[model samples]
Target: MIVPLRKCLVPEFILGDGATNLANRYIKFFNPKKVLVVTDRGLKKTKLVSNVEKQLKADNISYCIYDNISPNPRDYEVMEGADVYRKEDCNVILAIGGGSPTDAAKGIGIVSTNHHHIKSFEGVDKILAPMPPLVCIPTTAGTSADISQFAIILDTELKTKLAIISKTVVPDTSLIDAETTLTMDKELTAATGIDALVHAIEAYVSTASSVITDMNALEAIKLVKQYLPLTIKSPLNLEYRNKMMLASLLAGIAFSNASLGLVHAMAHALGGLKDAPHGMCNAILLDHVIDFNFESATNKYVDIGNAFGINLDSSNPASSKALLIEALQEFKHICGIQPGLKQIGLKKADFRELAQKAYNDSCIVTNPKDAEIADIEKILEYAW
Candidate 1:
């Protein structure tokens, strides 16, 4: 038997209670003239950003803040952040929020170093030059943009999300602290938790899945299944928050290496077209994509069901698939995600365009089953 070659990419990371406080030490290692602190306006209302700034100031590290980022980070926002980086004479980027801020920070680094519009580096390895040093402090327990080799940026004109995959975009360091997640409300928690679950499921069933990625993906799924509901119930429980953060980290490593599948591909399209929440989009489309790809990867789906504590009989693949899909829908509702595509403003007429964009997304390449535009449209219809 022959084995295929595979590679895993992850940034250096420190995890625990005080992980964010180490920002000063890591930024000082770069000896940057100034740091570009990228974050969204939502985080600005919290003490998370100011707390990190206090640490930077204690180390005499100068920094400037850019909070012009939105939920689905736009192309122009990336360019604007790059301009801020240049104008502020910053050599390092320290992102201190969720996926939007971290992804925007990556985009800013790309344009600032490569000297190209953010839209040019849309697909895989389009980045020719290495980005500036980046340090991420992720406030959300989902997206995992802190360590992944992927960044999602929305095109304002096209109203579509661009999937940027490259080792160059990976951060230099990630400060993964569950403390920051304490500020998240129940809705944000449910959405992001489901996003991490989708990442694990897709990675496990991806065409590129390897033994190493499978291990990470399965463990992540188990963690999310067991702890996500507990966190929603005990919103202020640090222990629950820590578990979800670890789940996100493991899922990030798995997907970053094995890549994602149709769920992510279609979710990206839906998010860009509707400006809807990315995680919510993934949550709505997850079970439908699983049903679409289940026959192609029955064993993998059974494993995922086992991770979810479902004793699926692989011999009865059809029954097992239906049982797993039913459980997934229940889990989504249990976690408080109740909206479908229509509730989020997607129309029946838009399915064709959304399906076309999803088909063209880089993530579609690794789906366990090859999907046509019509197949994606069917998935969208089912999700609706």
Candidate 2:
């Protein structure tokens, strides 16, 4: 058999404790005229953003802050941020929050340099020009937008989400400091941690999955399974927190190359339509999508079982699959994740639109099992 060609992409990442402090060094290296520090209002209360500000001030690196970002970043937010970037004469983008801020920063870069509306660059590789230099300090570990080629931007007019899949949107550098994640509440930690798990699982089973991506995905799954609950119990435990950060990084690398599947597709729609949390949406849809995808990717599911520490009986595939599902369910319960989409205000009437949008999502193309609108609707029903 002739193996197809593949490519892997990742950002220049500095990972460890106090890695965020290196922001000034990178800023000086880039030597931009000025910098835009993109973040959400919530993170402003934490010392993390302030610390970065202090460092930038100490280094005399002129910078401005765009703190209007929300959990699910919208099109207007990107446009507004682009205006800020251009008006402030900021040539570099520095993001200092979770997925929202990071994703927003990517959007700001696109519009800043491309001189086009953010929504115009919705689909894959729509961006022709390179974006401004981006430096990411990931506060909560999930979305992986800092390291990935995917940027999810919500369209306020359409009341849905669109994905911008392109290498140009990937950050130039990421400071993965575990210390920045210490201030996250338990709910945020659980949601983002599970989001990392879903990223690994979907990437591992994707049709685009390569040997390298599979390796990263499996390691990410193991780390999340082993450390997520512990981090919740001991939120201040740097060891567990750092491990989860590593898992998120590994999963980001994996999914950014391999792409994701139904979980993300559905989550994107939920986040856009219901104004739900991306990680929470992923957490709710993950198990059901896994179950939907199991038959087509049995061997991969067995691998997942192993990653989750479920001893699988190779002789009985059904038993192995069940064990994996049980393990995931137990983890969900331990993380205090709510049971269904209904809990997040997903109405039955909204199922059709959600299903159609998910079916059209870019991530759905790589799913192990092909999901049509009906199939997606069924999955949403199950999740509901």
* Best of the candidates, TM-score: 1
1-384: candidate 1 lDDT, tens digit per residue: 566789878889999989888999999899889999999988977787888889988888899999999999999999999999999999999999999999999999999999999999998999998999999999999899999999999998999999999999999999999999998999999999999999999999999988888999999999999999999999899999999999999999999999999999998898999998888999999999988999999999999999999999889999999999999999998998865889998999999999999999999999999999989999888889
Computed on alpha carbons, the lDDT of every model, listed in order, comes to 0.93, 0.91
**Please, what is the TM-score per model?**
0.98, 0.98
Model 1 misplaced stretches (Cα beyond 4 Å): none
- Residue pairs with backbone overlap in model 1: none
lDDT of 2 at 143: 74
Pairs clashing within candidate 2 = none
* Top candidate (lDDT): 1
Name model 2 segments beyond 4 Å from true.
1-3
